[model samples]
Each structure stands twice: as C-alpha cells, then as structure tokens.
Target chain A: MKYIKVAGVVVFLLLWQLAGQINPGIYSSPTLVVTEIVRLFTEGGLLGLVFGTVATMLLGWAFAAVIGVFTGFLIGRYRLASLVLEPYLVALYSVPLIAVVPLLVIWFGIGQTFLLATIVVATGIMLVFPTAAGTRETVRVYDQVARAYCVSGRHFLFKVLLPGALPFIATGMRISVQRALMAVIVGQFLVGHPGLGTLLSDARVRLDADEVFAVALVALAVGAALTALVGWADRTLSAWRPEVTS
Target chain B: MTLAHGKTAAPTRLAALTGPGPVRDWTIRVAAFCALLLAWQLAAQNVSVAVLPTPRRVWEGMAGLLERGDLQLAWGQTAVQVAAGMLLSAVFGVVLGVLIGWFKPVDDAISPLLNAVFLMPRIALVPLIALWFGLQDTAKIALILSFSFFEIFFTVRNGVKTIENEFVEVAKAYCIPQWTVLRKVVLPAITPYVMTGLRLGLVYALVGVVLGGFFLESNGIGGLIYALGSDFRTAELIAALFTVMLVGLAVNLGLHRLENLLAPWKVTR
Candidate 1:
C-alpha cells in the first residue's frame, strides 16, 4: 500500500510534467514549481508576503476566538439569549462571508484593516456553532455535578464550564484557522493587498503559471502548518479532559 | 402553609423566566431584531453613507435593483450556475467517493492526492481556472464544482468507511451479490452523509458562484456586488449582500427540512 501510494504520486508528477511540456503556458510541472518557489524566496520577497498574510490571519483569528467563545458561552448558558440569537448566528454562519468582502473593502478601504476585517468576518462566526454546542453539552452533563459540589458563579464558569468545553472550542479553533487562512489569501487577492495573494495575482497578470503554482504550494504549506498547530494546541489543552471525565 | 406556597411560587416564576416558550421566544427574537436595526440606524447616521448606508437606503437600493430587473436577472444567472454545478458535483463526487472508499487499490492510490488538493484553498485556484476556462459560464460552473465537490466526496467516502464490516461479511456468507450488498448495506449507511454533503455543498457552491462572478465574469449577483462595491455604491452593495444571505439562509433551512424528512434518524448539524 505504501509503495502504491508513492508510485501513485510519482506517476501523477510524471503526467503533470508531460502535460507541462506540451502546454508550458497553462501547465506548471513539479520541478518548475519548485524552482519558482526557491526563486520567490531568494529574490521575490516571498517571506514578507507570507508574514503579512499569516500575521493578519492570526490576529483576526484571535479576535474571532474571543468573540465567538464569549458569545457562544452566553447563548449556551442562557436559554433566552439562545432563542433570540441562534437563528441570526445560523444565518450569518451560512452566508458565504466572501460575499461581504467587497462591502468590507468599501467600509474599511483596501488595506490591512480591510484584510483583517475580511478574515474576521469570514472565519469568526464559524466558531460560534461549535463553541455553543460544546458549552451547552458541558452544562447539560456537568451542571448537576457542579451543583452537587456547591460550585456556582464565576468559579463554575471558569473551572467547570470552560474546561469541559475545551474540546469543542479547540475543534472550532481548528476549523476557523483554515477559514482564516483562506479569508486572508482571498482578501489580499481581491484587494491587491501586500501578501502572497498579491504575489499570486501578479503572477496571474504575468501569465506565470509556474509562479502561481509555487505560490499556491506556499499557501498549502501555511494552511497545513496552521491546521497542525491548532491540532497540537487542542491535544495539549484537552489532555486533562479524559482524567476529569473518568 | 402560606410561606411554603410563596417559596414554590417564586421558584416556578424563575423557571418560567428561564425556560423555553414559543410566545416568549418569538417576542425576544422580534425585539432583538428591532434593537439591532436601531443600532445600525444610529451607526449609519454617524458614518458617511458611502461607508455605511442606512437601512432605509439599503431598502431603496434593493427597490431600485428590483425596478431595473437587475436583481432578478443577476440572481437567475447565479442560480442556474450554482444548480448546474451542484448537480454535476453531486453525481461525480458520489461516484468517485464510492469507488475510492470501496476499492483498496484505488483508495491507496488516490486518497493522498485528494487530501493534498483538499488542503489547498480552492479560492487560490480561481485565477488559474479563469485562465483555463475564460470568462464564461463554464468557468463559473467549474469554479463552483471545484469548491463544492470535496465536501460531498469526503463525506460520502468517510460514510462508506463507517459501514460495518460484519454487515458485508454477513452478506457474503449469505451469497448476496456485490451490487446488492452495496445497495443494501453501503448505500443505506451513507445516505446521511450524502444529505450532509448536499447541505454543505450548497453553501460552498454559493461561495464559488460569487467568486466566479467577481473574478471570472460579472454576470451574476457577485458581479453586481463587485460593480457596486468598486463604485462605492454602499447601499446597493449591502442590498446585494442581503440577497445572498437570504438565499444562503433559505437553502440551509430548506436542506435541513429535507434532511429531516429523508433521514429522520440521523440528526445532522
């Protein structure tokens, strides 16, 4: 199975190379993409672009986390709040946030603020559902235990509720991180912001397929790294969950 | 006895305040909505109309688009593209997902590739797709497909994986044919996932169609939005965005109803 997987990738690359040879304008082979990536790093200031996009993504994600978790906790803890807010949250969540980027650009202008707002708008609401669900579930399961222990108020919220909801919050974080990355890239691409997305758009304008592919590869790596980082955080934070549950 | 009755009354009142009731819920929803609108109105009054249009301006803008038939025309184009692309995605995604999930060799060869592609933001490929397909409905549909296909494919593939091996074993022992086993065992098990995929795919397809309108060609609501936004027509842009949001909410609610009807036992989020 392992050999077959390796062979499959090799064959896929070879076919791509062949295709690139035939239509070098549209198709970018693996080797060419690698070369372009190295050149981009060395001369194209790819690091700065990466930093710009990632920094915006992370900052926006942090804001989203705070807002989502707080709102989610409130709604989950209070039935009246949930009844009033859940529908709106669901509607906001379902709406393709990309649709609002243009509106955001107009409101915030085509720069870092716009980019940050886009990321927040795109990815923030996503965290709400999972966090709310997690909080609700935690209350349902542990409310009695906490009551029995004479726990209430902030002590209950911090020591009991939040800890119990960590897994769900972590899951939300992981998912939101992915959206954050996509949001920043697409935001920069649409607005011509100084990021990897701009690099991609520039390559597109030049009709540099190899450079586009290379930039896409860098984006993929960033996405993967963010996802992995979130996963790691989730695992580390939730390590105590099993012991508590048991 | 009077003191005990008073205590009971107090607790019951508290319970009523905290508990779910239809009348109270609707009242709260309406009140919250009004408050939100008021807040928006106040904020809009403070800001430039070009930056944040008042709710009334947005209403007027929507009416203007309606009068000019721009809203209907653009929405119609987007609807057609999204529907067509989603239909194709459902067909191809299910077939490919099933094949990959059920066959070991295919899964081994293709799963890694699929995962790699899945991790890459499909939005980043918009320009590349535009280059290949040009500014046509084909590009729009292709973009939609690229965005939506993975949700259905991955859902169905994982659904197939979750099918109990014992069921397949029992079918084999009973001499049931492979196709019958698939129909009876695999299909039933994965229907919930398919429903979920369709729900998710519809949302992603909306995103794709909007992106296509923005980047590829300006024919749909996305194009209308892009045009309005670039011109700083804030009122019209908000109206157009509201339209998209309504469509999304409607699709989400509609699919949820359909899923409940089709797969009542499977509660999906």
Candidate 2:
C-alpha cells in the first residue's frame, strides 16, 4: 500500500507526459517542469525569488512573534486587558487577509520593498490574540514565587512567564507563519514584486504552464520547508504537550 | 455581537476567579484607533482632499455614493457573489471531506496527493481556472473550490478518523442504521471540526474568489478594487478596501458567534 501510494505520483507524472505528447498546449510534462526547475536553479533567479518572499515572511513573522508574545504576556498577566483586547483580536483575525493587500499597496507603493511592508501589515496583527491569550493563561503562582524572591523584570520574563507560556507562543507562531507566508504570496501576486511570486506571475503572463508549475513546485517546497522547520522547532523546544498545545 | 464597552469591566470582578495582572492592562481597548481618527480630523484641517483626503471627506464620499445609490448596488452585488461562493464551498468542502474521511481506502489513495497539491497556493491554479471557466463568476467558484476543498477535507478527515472506536461499537451493537449513525453520532461528534473547517476554509474561499475577481473582471469588490487601485486613485482604493474589510469583518464576527453557539467547548482552539 505504501509502494502503491508512491506509485500514484509516478503514474501521475507518466500520464502527464503522455497527455503533453497528445496535446502539448495545455498539459505540461513532469520532465519539462523538472528540467525547468533545474534550469531555474542554475540561473540563480529562482533562488533570489524564493529568498525575497521568504525574507518578507520571516520579518513579518518575527514582528508578529515579538508583539504577540508581549501582548500575550500582558493579557495573561491581567484579566481586564485580556477581556477587552481578545474580542477585537478575534474579530480582526477572522477577516480575509487578501482584502487588505490593496489598502497596503495604496499606503505603500507597488513593487520593490513596499511589498515586504505590505506583507507585514497583512500578517502582523494575527499574532497578537494567541500570544496575549497565552500570556494571560500562564500560571500566576510562578509569578508570585518569583516576586517573593524579588525577581527582576528580565529574569521573571525569561524564567517564569516566557518558559511557562512557550507552548502558547509556539502554537501562535505556527499559525502566524502559515498566514504570513500566504500574505506574502498574495501581496506579491497582486501587488507584483521580484520573487517567486513574480516569477509565477511571469509564467502566467507568458502562458507558460510548465514554467508556472515549476515555479509553483518551488513555492510549495518553500512553504512546506517553512512549515516543517518551525513545526519541528516548536515540537523540539516543547518535547511535550505542556510547552506547545495542539 | 454587541459586546459593548461595559462588558470589559468584568475583569475587576473576575479577579476572584483568577490571579495575576495581565502584562498590558489598559483603560481603553481601541484608544489607538480613536487617537488616529482624532489625528486624522485634525490633520484634515490643513490637508487637501486630492492628496490625503480627510476622514470627513472619505465619510462624505461614502455618504454621497450611498445617496447616489451606486455604493448600495455595488455592495449588494459584491455581497451576493461572496455569499454564494462561500455557500458553495462549504457544501462541497464538507461533502468531499466527509467522503474521504468516512472511507479509509479513499483517504489512503488521496491524502498524500492532496497534501502535495495544497502546498501549491490556490493562486497557483487561478490561471488554470481562468482558462477553463473564463472571465466569469464560474472562475471565481472554481477558485473557491480549489482554495477551500483541501483544508476542509484535511480537518474533517482528521476529525472523523480520530474518534474513539467504543462509540462506533456501541452504535453497531444498538443496530443504529448506518445513515442514522452517521447523522446522529458521527456528524454531531465531528461538528467541532466541521465548524472550525468552515470558519477557516471560508476565509480561503473568500480570498480566492476576490483575488480571482481582480483578473476576471467581475462586478465584485475585487474587480472594483483592481480597477481603482491600478489607476492610482488611492482614495477610491481606500474606500473599496474599507468596504471589503467591513464585509470580511462582519462575516468573521458572525462565524465566531456561530462557532461559540455550536461548539462552546472549543473556545481556545
């Protein structure tokens, strides 16, 4: 059954090639996409494209993490603030991320570095709710014990709340990373920029289905790698459910 | 829906319920927003409408458009498109997801395929849909299907597959009809996952439809936004964005309420 499952993909590619031979205009062969992927790699253009978008996503994710953790800590620490802020965060997080791309593009210009900023704006707000909730929900006794020893702000943050709330931060971060990546892609897709998104856009404009598929494969690899990387980190750091809740 | 400012006062009382002060407690939840509005009003006194249009000017623009009946018509048209697309995705996504979940053979055959395909953003398939369906509402629907089908399927499949076997055995012992067992037991039990799937998947569908519309020339907000934004009419783009955000916010808030009612046990998740 495992072998059969792997064969499904191979069979799919073989069939795709056959389809291309029958009608080259619509279906692109896996061989061609693979060859294109190799070509894209050697040319170094694809690397830049992947990096550009990845950089933006990482920046936004970093921003979201810092702000989200701070807010989460605050919310976890105080009951009133959590109640007040949670509603708005939940309300805002539900909105479709794409709707803001245009406004972001308007505020920032189209193309170049503005696209990064646009991606940040689109995904930054998402981190606030989860982290704040994580913070608010952290155990108070840890804080009390720390206070009894006159724990410094930095010490208390690093020793008590941060470690205790690591699981929440990890979960929130995992959620935000996917969203931030999606926002970056969409921002680049619509707003147009120099990256894998732009490469994909170029493929579309030229109607190079094979090139588009190849570029998409690269993006998929990037997306999957990002997910797996952060996910592994989260799981490793926690090593148990107590650190990162599913 | 109306969780008014007064409800925020519960923290002082709920202190008996819990411990510790939240890290960033504040008097106002949206003070930054209010501050910005006030700043905008003050800045508008010196700014030109053509440049940085005042909040008042924007409000006037919104009012005038509504008064002229164009805004209402546009909103109505866009709302219908979004609603219809969302409904279609929800129905198809759930059905497809449930089928794959309920049947292990199908899940075995299709899960990896889907995992690979979903990694490629739905926007990757927009051109394929456009070529197949052309610049029509159908393209948007196709895009919606592509965006939504995978997420809902994954969630639902995981949901149903993860259930305890004891309940199924109990149902079998009682000789519950297969369909009744599905409806009465399976559906209710997986309702939490389905609700989560719907809530999340609809966002994907909404974005796919709207983004696809930018290139498809539909009469929806996406089309209007693309038209206006591409023209460098910042103010109009801002207006269109506000309208889009308003609708999105409304849908999300509405879903949160529905989720709370349907699955109160899943507040944190």
Error of 2 at B152 (Å): 2.5
lDDT of 1 by residue, B116-154 (tens): 878878877766776677779998999999999999899
lDDT of 2 by residue, B1-269 (tens): 36555565555555633434442344244564576688987876775544456786677666665677655766676667666777876787688777777777677767777888776666666656654566577777777777877767778777778653736679989998877877888888788888888877777767776777665555676776676666655566666667766777777668778988989875434
Model 2 deviation from native, Cα RMSD in Å: 5.5
Q: Taking the tens digit of each residue's C-alpha lDDT, what string does model 2 give over A119-197? A: 5566666666656655655555475677789986788778877777777677767766666777777777776766766
Q: For residues A1-246, could you state the per-residue lDDT of candidate 1 as single tens digits?
A: 999999899899999999999987799888899999999999999998898788888898888888889888878888878878888887898788789988898878888888878887888887787778888889999999999999999999899888888888887887777788888888888988889778767866776788777877887788777777887987787676643220
Q: How much lDDT does each candidate structure score?
A: 0.85, 0.70
Which model scores highest in DockQ? 1
Residue B75's C-alpha lDDT in candidate 2? 65
